[model samples]
Target: MAELANCPRCHALFVKGPAIVCNDCVKREEEDFQLVYSFVRKKENRTAAILDIVRETGVEEYKIREFVKSKRLHPAQFPALSYGCERCGAEIREGRLCESCTVSIRSGVQKQGELDDLEARNKKEGLGPVTYYTVNDDNR
Candidate 1:
């Protein structure tokens, strides 16, 4: 017999079964995995975008995406399997990008945050859109 210590996470004595982790840690991890799996499996939740999961589960977007990518064994088998972008929340079909995101990517690279970005930044900073005066002295 070897030494038996209570798991720090679950506070349960270690066992040599399906898990090297203590039962409590395993249960906690299993619960987290289930939450992630459910979020990925459901259609509405699937399209819920990236930050949604971050907000809901407090897991980082990149880590969540990695989990989705690595956990999926068969690619074609899971046609609907996808993750969302923190920017748009649209389903990333593969390589973590949807069609619109692909286009936006090309366009954003061209502008490099010259347009529309100002508005996003303003919003981020808690400032509403600024009304501009046109050449004709009219509000734009």
Candidate 2:
């Protein structure tokens, strides 16, 4: 069901549906997409990077990135069209993080798990920090 909300792009009140923007903004975005598409569809421009496409089409970088993310622009067809990894800002065609960052994060998580396991073992074995206790037998 559509809900009433303000459009993010034009600040117009619109019934929010599948699209987050208003109808006017959606039309404008379609125009921008066409411009960007025409520029990149050419054989020579197939190897053009995202910045190059943005410069030629006068479209914003984020919009181009969105196109790539949505698979509206296939990076396989246009070798240079790519968005940044969410972690290290390296250019990537799919997923949030690039290969190296993913590996690094995975390694970090594994190490953390190892540390946690060791700590748990130490705790279970009563091998934690030393404590002193004094004997008091006066009451007895």
Candidate 3:
């Protein structure tokens, strides 16, 4: 069901559906995407840096970064283009977080793994098996 809500981008009344922003904002974003795409499609412009593209084509850097993040822009073709890490805001070619953040997350996982291993080892060594004794009805 669509709910009546104000558009986040333009603050206009719009039906809230699958899209985050209103139709007008979506149209504007499409136009921006087309403009950015046209600029980067040229062989000469393919190697241009994100900042340079922004300066030359008048497209916002964040839009280009969004394209990169969404896999709309291929990094192999555009060598000078990179997106900011979602965590540290450092530049990276692929993925949301940068290498440092990735390493930090990995270290955390390693610590968790160590704790899990220790718990399992303790459970195996500390717990004793329960002894069951069965009495025959004839004996009773």
- Give the candidate number with the greatest lDDT: 2
Q: How many steric clashes does model 3 contain?
A: 0
Please give the CA lDDT of all the candidate structures: 0.65, 0.91, 0.88
Query: What lDDT would candidate 3 get against the real structure?
Result: 0.88
Give residue 21's lDDT in candidate 3 (0 to 100). 87
Of 2 and 3, the candidate ranking higher by TM-score? 2
Instruction: Itemize residue pairs with steric clashes in candidate 1.
Output: 49-89
**Candidate 1 structure lDDT:** 0.65
Q: Highest TM-score among the candidates is held by which one?
A: 2
Model 3, span 1-140: residue lDDT tens: 77999987789999899998899998988888889889888998999988899998787898899988888888887888889998889999998899899999999999999978877887889854445899899977
RMSD of each: 13.7, 7.5, 12.1
Which pairs clash (backbone N, Cα, C closer than 3 Å) in model 3? none
Could you estimate the TM-score for every candidate? 0.36, 0.80, 0.79
Q: For residues 36-140, what per-residue lDDT tens digits would candidate 2 score against the true structure?
A: 998988889989988898778899999999999889999889888888899899989998999999999999999999989988988999899446898899977
Better model by lDDT: candidate 1 vs candidate 3: 3
Worst 10 residues of 3 by lDDT: 122-131
**Number of backbone-clashing residue pairs for each candidate, in the order shown:** 1, 0, 0
State the lDDT at 137 in candidate 3.
96
